[model samples]
Target: MDKIVQFVQKSEHNATAVAIFGAIGVAVVALKALSFLKVLVDVFLRSGINLKKYGAGRGGWA
Candidate 1:
């Protein structure tokens, strides 16, 4: 933690770059987490459309 503070205080440009990249990294991780949660919800809490109703694999005029 102290090292990080020292590094940031070393230069304004370095601090800015670090802040930008950190925010981007945080956003990417958050998006990935949300996507994973959505997948879990889809798999366990929601049902997909029934393909049988559309005649998918019923040998109906492929």
Candidate 2:
């Protein structure tokens, strides 16, 4: 496709910009993956969570 060709032939500045944006995108995706794994592990592993023992989250509404 024409767009692919243009992307392949991008100027140095554009290429650098693309690389930086791509790195940022990768980091965001990795963070999301890590968060999902954390939630999955908590769902399967965290047991007998006594919020009652912790008490009503500093109750007494303002």
Best by TM-score: 1
Per-residue lDDT of model 2, residues 1-48, tens digit only:
889659857777777887899899999999999999999989998885
TM-score of each: 0.72, 0.67
Residue lDDT tens for model 1, 1-62: 99999999999998999999999999999999999999999999998898888898979775
lDDT of 1: 0.95
lDDT of 2 at 39: 96
- TM-score, cand. 1 vs. native: 0.72
lDDT of all the models against the reference?
A: 0.95, 0.82
Cα RMSD, model 2: 5.3
* Model 2 TM-score (2 dp): 0.67
Please give the range of 10 consecutive residues that has the lowest summed lDDT in model 2: 53-62
